[model samples]
Target: MRMRKILPACVLSCCLTGLMAPAAFADGCPDQEIAVETLKMKRAEDSEKAGKLKEAFNAAKTVAWECLGNDAGKRREALIKRVGRTLGDQEEKQGRLKEAFDWYLAAGLEADADRVMLKRANAKPDDTNAVGNAIDHFKRRNNEARVREMRGIAARNVDKWLTAEDKAFAARKDSREELGKARDWVYYAEAGSGKVTERAEKRGDTLATDDARRSIENAIAYYQFADKPQKAKGVRDKARKLGDEHARKGENKLAVEFYSLAGDDAKAAALEKKSEAEKQKTESARQDKFKKDQQSLEKELGL
Candidate 1:
């Protein structure tokens, strides 16, 4: 009985040792390039499954570059793509967006890379410094669509900052310095994204335009209430120009609002009158159309 137990134990130990031993490269490929690539690719997959991403990434880098050029049969291409995608996902989850983007690109996934970059820009939409950095990153990469989107985000963040600043200023009438700092952020938003304001206006987004106007009005109120008319001159000029531009476009109501903000009571009142007249004129035209339709129906029926 003892001899039988020892024989079984020795057999088990030999089997375990063989299984744990490093894999031989003899069965991989006859060519050196193929052999090296095959070995590294297998190692990469194993390391990744074992949660050793750093080792996986290093191994994958070698396989992704070297294997593609060596393997004419495209044997390792699928594994290389898989490794690149996996590394990108891991890096993105860790907030390493730049690395993730590069990995995705190397995987030949351009759309995935762009999406990751956009997410990076949107990650800190409410943070001025962070959003600014994201915008700069997109700009340097010549991503025009992403730059525009980032600018819109920056403008929105400025609005949020202005709202908080408004509450603080209201609570403390002596918070001129704080208000001035808030105005600087507003300026930064406009300066950082030259097209944001123009695009907002052209898009006819009522809420977006209102948000922008409110922020600018807050700045004007701050300077005017602080008895600094000279300092508010530039803002007043901008408001006046906006009003004139709206009036020329036949947006009399918006023009009136802007003129009022500029402290141009006369221009605002005149624009308001024009808007009322235009509304009445439009109503009258609708009524006339209704009457004409009724008369045509009566004539057709010989009523």
Candidate 2:
């Protein structure tokens, strides 16, 4: 009878110990399931920060599903939101604008969806489809105020683009007229005899209006036609000065024509004396300008 009682007590104690062992192990440390899920969530967050959006999305999805499976209501909700946000971000980075917007909407971020839709609408200027889509998204969010504003902006942008196109065409036409006037000035200013006034009237004072090409051409005509050597020298000197001014301003093409009109033979003699003197002056000026510019740029950059 003693042995039977002892055996029954041993069996009961073993069963209780078996039951308590799992509980003891479970209590000794943090919850393994929650710990694993948290680690995954952290991994996802790190990946996201490192710009590995796709991997982050996968990990976040796993965490969200696990939390949901465990019946963690608040945690599940939060994880779902995080997963949706991560996926949406990934889609956006990949240029899947519509997909990203949908995900944001699913995550209950209507404002974010609207913002992305607006960006998408702006990207495709000619595509009315994108604009229509954005409008639909705004409507779904009940953002009537924003929808109306965007519609106005779209209409304004279309009108602005049309006006700009018309202006560009007009500018091109004006440039052609200016070029023709420049050519006429060159012709008239070159003519030595006859009524210089009549020729001048036809071309007008187009050269005086800062038309560098016309001015240079007129200067050339004067150098070629002047009979007296003294008059020629004076005209050539004036032309040379104009050339130098244009060269300093980096208008090399206009400068070349004027310089050529100064006559090649005269230039060769002057070059030897002027080159070294001009170099020293230009270098000094450049150094001063560079220092000033560096100071200005540093201030602008907040460096």
Candidate 3:
């Protein structure tokens, strides 16, 4: 048989510990990891102080990743959050709303995202793409509150646009080009209102119908400001078509408004009567729900 025997205890212990040394050293990160990460943090702070915020954000993100990879994630959470917030602020200052929102979301700051998006929506009335992108982002996240806030922002911005267009049209009332611009703004504002109305109606929200009505009124005014009735005839025909579609869907109020715009006075009057009746019925339903809720609450209170 081959000679086989256990090593001395002291020698075995030394050999085993030697074998574990590298692992233990790894568990306790190398000095270089710590030193490099620390230096990166310092660099980030210095860059921020120097107003080179983009560089600061990048360096700080590197530190965050290093800490996460080194088993220091919990210890570095606050630092990561701080870095993310700083990145959002820096990007917002640079007028990069989408980037700011992304950083705010990364920082776990939903409220900050909402605030920044609201600011962006309010500031970029003429920038349709920006507003549309922000709306789509909120919608995809199923952020109903932010969507509502954005809708208000959109409606308010539409109002501003309509006001500006109206002023422009008034100044150049005889210009067909100006009239065309007015028409375009009215369409834009109405489309914005329709978006708000659609979303709100889905949620049973009774809000902002006034905004839609105002847009419709402005649209009609734009038609009046046009050089010839023929210039507005296409829009009028479209309105009538829309009215008929709404009527088929039992949306008599909208039908009435559109028919009136299309100069179908008889149809408008008939639809207005039906619309009033529908409004009363809806109000009665709401009151019934409120009363039932009150009765349930009173019963629960033994009153």
lDDT of 3 by residue, 1-303 (tens): 223344466678899898877532233567667667767777877877787866765676677444335444443455556767888988999999878988988767778987887788778855666666667777877987766665655556655654554465456432234334333443434445443223222221121122254444444454444333453565566677878998999878788888887788999998888778879999999999999999999999999
Candidate 1, position 252, lDDT: 84
In the range 131-239, model 2's lDDT, one tens digit per residue, is: 6676677777788876775565555444444345335435532222333332333332232223323232322223323335455355334333322345446556666
* Overall lDDT per candidate, in order of appearance: 0.66, 0.59, 0.63
TM-score of each: 0.39, 0.31, 0.40
Q: Model 1: how far is 115 from its true place, Å? A: 1.3
Regions more than 4 Å wrong, model 1? 1-42, 45-53, 63-68, 72-80, 90-108, 173-303
Highest lDDT among the candidates is held by which one? 1
Model 2: runs farther than 4 Å from truth? 1-71, 157-303
- Better candidate by lDDT, 2 or 3: 3
Worst 10 residues of 3 by lDDT: 200-209
